[model samples]
Target: MRTLTRPAARRHIERVFDATVLDVLNSVDLVDLRVVVLQGGEQGGPPAIAIICESLGQIDLGWIETGDAPVAWRAAAYRALDQSLGRVLPIYGYQYLFDEIAMYYWDGETEDDAARQSLIAYHGADADELENMALPSEMNARRPAWMIAANAAASKRLPTALRRKLDTLDRASKALGGLESERNAWNCDFEIIQDYIPGYEECSSLPPLTLVPFEQFARELDDIARNGMEMGFMDIAGLCPLPDADRIDDWFTALRRGVQLLVAAQDLIRLDPTQL
Candidate 1:
């Protein structure tokens, strides 16, 4: 039998917690549940629920019946999941206090047709192509230009300020088009995969767990946090640093702008699995 180290044990526990959240989402009738991962900056990690929005903002009675009161129930659900997982799992070395909100939508017969069409259009294959082609990985690696085009179309419908920000992002995407092989560009692609599809499991034929220990992990979470902080400060500093003010103001502004763009893009992208 393999001996599980503290970190290994903690990871197993975290997986269980993640699995639990997946179960809850899978069983419910909620159209779509968004799960945002929250992460802490330091060793004393602060874990919190980032956001939870239901489809059409309808309250599901099944969710509420299971000890989830109607009042601020989203936070309550997060706390319940946190407490349950914390009790059974050891969370060490998972210092990044990020909360991943898994958006789960109800799967139905309608989804089958959409999935078929998406598979045919994207890979020139049908459902059986799961064995022949790694569609998700391919799509994730090099997102279709159509996706951004769709986003651009949607952004035009937004308010003036947000539309301008989306236009800037479109420009940025265009500027970076041919440079996808660059380190920074690849990082951006990976970040999107991590953010939007946190629990994406590779096909069964592939290795089950790809996550590595802290020392073995390729990316440094702390470095990412520090870089984000620094970038924020520099943005606030603008062309010249202020005499006495903190430099993160510009960073926050940029962050807000980026978020607005995402919101606008989300509105444009039909997230419906059936829509594909």
Candidate 2:
């Protein structure tokens, strides 16, 4: 890892943590469901819970909550999501979407006077010189993953080797998915073949684990999904230097490690919480 100051490193870790949790929520089709359900009826539930399961069909939600295939999928999803986010986010200048929002609107910075003063401080120029600069509202929007990646690529923060690896993995994963779909269609028209093929084993979905590692991943995801809004964004720009190539490399290493662990765990009958 890059030798960042303690607070800066912590900020990066927290961002990774939040993104990983969100990734898990999305993977299990639970992005729209509440992580923790309180005493209130569903209709009168907390705002966080209200939006939970909004993206899921009733059937999908039921499977995740009660079925073996889905629960195991959830565990694997957690690992994949965590790995992907940890590797990807650092590439994009070590900044997150929330960081953009915080710059323009959060923490009582809504007023023109406050914002002007802040901008003046940032640019270290007089108000007169900064008058024609774009307002934060005009410039700000949530940065999508692709946009972040593009920014990193533009700045040369994403190394060539890492880029090629990411691209290769993405294309291979898509090809496997396509193969599965084609096979399913063929099975519909003909007979099922018990033949060996790379990734064919993945075609047979595993049951969810009843293990502690799975539970821990699920629980952490639940907490973040439910209470992430309560956690404010960091002022990374003020506190930390823009991430350089070395920092980006650190994130890439972390992400690869996460993916490797996830691949190993998915095929296992047992998972230790300690490993997670």
Candidate 3:
């Protein structure tokens, strides 16, 4: 697959993030609360979102009792932003260097640690003091391989017993043309097994084993499975798109390494669950 250029990647990032924000805002219970989008950073950068508390200090926290209240709205905004950042950023190839979210308050007048820390703590940074706050650190060039392994392991839906049933078929599909008979048998077995996997759509269509080679079909299936699995894992992991251009490939390399580690880990786990 072709990688996206930086500009196209940023556009994709903005579009997905905008959708995420809209969904979050629509769910808010307040009537007057609005989310404001402003151009962030220097020329040619993605927009930053702010939860506009129109009346600010005058807001009747009591009347606005739902999750859209000043406190909750800000919380929700950060949540949406963080979740979007975590999931979308990586697709274009980027990873957050740090865990803390950034904020620019009072019309972007000041950007001191006190302000950052207060904002972070107010919105749920678990730190006792500004010194302990972790909001404004630099982004790392690469993500740890373990994170990708975690993503893969997290995406697995089949139990060990169920997955084991495909061993013969999977092995046959890997070998030479001797697997024609094995593929046909696997197709039949998959028809029955796929049904037992409640809500699993992956194995729904068993392209007649005679029409297309099992190896070809397997590649197609793998693409579909990887997309679904990664999306699910990213959502749960709270990763976002990497805005920085320089380190995108580094992040991708880390992700590949993570996938490799995950496959190895799975093998080990299968060999001896107790030892692992």
Candidate 4:
């Protein structure tokens, strides 16, 4: 990223285009005798080269007057210039030229040339292939904890319904003492059943209660399970908000019908009737 002001970028493009025109024209001898003689200052130069240069020069003048140039040639010229400069240019200047000058009908050129050149100049070569290259080891390294926290904060700006759900989940987890248990057992190797009672309570409380329908609840649980398997438990922990423990008993009672429906479906699908 070489930072360039708008005017500077435009001037750079104009200069490159002018140089290309001159380079093409200088190789011919269609110009006046004085100009042709001037081009022959070096020994062993072909006269035909002078003629071609002059012809190209005249063509370039006409192109400048009409504000148009051949696309393939323009692309080649720009590519060469980009390679020499070793920096990306702003897309605005190219877009301006394409809209203003290239879109109109011009002598000896089609709009496709201008469009193709613009595309190449903006997108560069084979972006997909370039993306396939492996990232640096440093980029793959774990990010700082603060960065993770900041990102989580940014993403947590949920709609009111989702926010209430999250609040409910938090209260449920707190009532079940999940957070405290995790903190207490942080450094200990002990696997205590009491520590997991909160988790069981949280799940038990989530059934038919809350705004989430039974089918939606099942989908969310499935999503949590899949996410956990792929990204780890911590990543999937927030998939479901904590339910309200105070309302769990009533909620579960209300969901009995849904539960029975699910159980019936499961029983019907079982290979053996006894398995139900």
Candidate 5:
């Protein structure tokens, strides 16, 4: 039931990204950096990561002679760095600001904090960035209100499509284990539901019925019921610490919502046999 704080999640991404960038930088002799670090964004601004290097002492490169050594390194490292951080950032619930290996030089003070930071500071002007808005990280912030409806069983009953999907998921959960009660928010079965339907994880308000062909969705559910839970154990894990009482309170704050999703698949399947 414990949720990750923004600061903690941001730090996790930063650490992972720094390590990945350094490994990429060391892969080639063209780039020699004294220090590399990640500076997190302010209020959802893009994160700035820089690999500060004074000179490429070992390489006698045509590009260095042309004053495009950093540009060459960025071109070589862009794909590797992007793939690495793309895998890391989302798991911590933050957007990946597409940043790259940029160059800055300091001859007098390699170790001075203020001097080193001067060139890398956020300028409030955009440069050396690629804009890719098509893909967003899956682990972005969750909207608790959307996933668990406010009054699912009462006057604010969810649309038929959501209720139907939830019912299907509730059945698939039976194929494995499940959230035994409201006490268990970190249940593996529920996690499975979240996995199969990203709308649940992202708390996206998109209509569930149209996202995938119902027949395929139902087959996946049956396949999971037959096979997913056991394999899920290998990948799906619980939160580090245990859930607290407050989590339990939040779990059932809207009992009506819980009821809307708990209907039996047998009953639901009867209404529309195609889903099965």
Candidate 6:
């Protein structure tokens, strides 16, 4: 992980960004990559899609791998997953539409700044130059798993028709924060989150996890679904498109089957907190 002294980090952000207090970006880097094939159904389909899932305390986000799959298919992130963030902000990038771009971050230059700052990040097309730079991709995993667990465990949002068995749910209940694992899971999850997105709670924009019974601190995911926000805070990567000569028409939310499950939940589940 590349780091900058406090002053250096400030200069770097000002150099690349428009220097708007409205949207402050902190750091950017190309972290890792993966390879998988496609399997399109209707709304979403990509048989081969590489996906990475991560969790911190209560914040759970994912990364998607875009770009051509390697011939060997078994590349490593140099075991980048095994290391800690060292309190550094990790920004990333992607192709917005036709152009390629990298992602950047913000919030927490110091412990205090990190505690209570809110900044919007981006993917590709630099704020100053608006140039397309190549992002890095390092793939070295033996076999990446398809992981798309919901970030929300509260609201009783589980679907009536999705068919996740009770025993099955019971097993993954800690991450889901359900059954006996309710508040117990929430406390455990929150501490784990500090490691990944340290000082996230101090940001008022983010939802708080009160010890007041069972709650899900997934307001970021809600923002993404509601506001059409691009990948920044709680991010996703690696999308596949079926392109055409006239204009690209066939597009899928390429988490492969994992996304398919969410889409199914969306269709089958109603917006009722009592559903769970």
The global C-alpha lDDT for each of the candidates, from Candidate 1 onward, is 0.30, 0.31, 0.30, 0.26, 0.28, 0.25
Off by over 4 Å in 6: 1-110, 113-259, 265-271
Over 4 Å off, model 2 = 1-96, 99-148, 151-164, 172-226, 229-276
Best by TM-score: 2
Best by lDDT: 2
Order of the predicted models by lDDT, top scorer first: 2, 1, 3, 5, 4, 6
lDDT of 5: 0.28
Model 3 over residues 45-149: C-alpha lDDT tens digits?
Answer: 433322222221111212112222233322322222222221111121112111112222212213455556565556555445544533333212132222222
Can you tell me which runs of candidate 5 are displaced by over 4 Å? 34-46, 56-276
RMSD of candidate 5 to the true fold? Answer: 25.5
* Angstrom error at residue 28, model 4: 82
TM per candidate:
0.19, 0.20, 0.19, 0.16, 0.18, 0.18
Summarize candidate 2's per-residue lDDT along 70-92 as a digit string, tens digits: 23333333323333422211111
**What would the per-residue lDDT of candidate 5 be over residues 1-276, giving only the tens digit for each residue?**
767799988788669756754454443342233333223322332222222223311122122123222332222222222222111111111011111011122222223343234334542222332121111121112211111222124312434543554445444444323334333322334343443323434432111111112221243323322322332212221111113425434333222122222222223322331222
- TM-score for candidate 1: 0.19
The C-alpha stretches of model 3 lying farther than 4 A from their native spots are: 37-48, 54-276
TM-score of 3: 0.19
Better of 2 and 4 by lDDT: 2
lDDT of 6 by residue, 1-276 (tens): 998999999788556533331121111112222222234534443232222222212212221122222211101110111111111112211111101111122222222222123221333234353222212221111113211112222323334322243223222322222222211211223333333344534433221211110122133223322322222233222223233322111112112222322222223222222332
When 4 and 5 are scored with TM-score, the better candidate is 5
Model 6 per-residue lDDT at 225: 27
TM-score of model 4 (CA atoms): 0.16
